[model samples]
Target: MSLRALLVLVLLPLSGCVPRIEVAAPKEPITINMNVKIEHEIHIKVDKDVEALLKNQSGLF
Candidate 1:
C-alpha cells in the first residue's frame, strides 16, 4: 500500500478519539423532605399433624 493511504487510515481512527467540547447550563438548588411509617403484625398457627411430621422427619438424622 502507498504511504498516503496508510497515513489516511491511521489518522482516521485518531480523529475519532478527539475529545468533544461540552457546555453545561446553570441550575437552581432544591430541597426535599419525606416521612414514611410501616407496621407489621404476623401470627402463625401450626396443626398437630404437621407438627408431628416435622418432628419425625429422618432427614434431620
Candidate 2:
C-alpha cells in the first residue's frame, strides 16, 4: 500500500469524533431558595470587687 492511502485511512476514522453542540432557551423563570442562619456568642468579665447594679441612688446623702 502507498503512504498517502495509509495516512488517509488512518485519518478518516477520526472525523466521526467531531463534537456536536446544542443550545436551548428557557420559557419560564428559574426560582432559587437559600436559607441561612447565623449565631453569635458574647462573654463579659468584670473585677472581683465590683458589683453589678442597674440603678444605684443610695449615695445621695
Best by lDDT: 1
Taking all chains together, each candidate's TM-score versus the true structure is 0.39, 0.46
Query: What is the C-alpha lDDT profile of model 1 across 17-48, one tens digit per residue?
Result: 88999897659766566676889999977999
Off by over 4 Å in 1: 29-61
lDDT by residue (tens digit), candidate 2, 1-61: 9999999999999999999997977889888887879899998776644433322544543
lDDT of every model, 2 decimals: 0.85, 0.76
Clashing pairs in 1: none
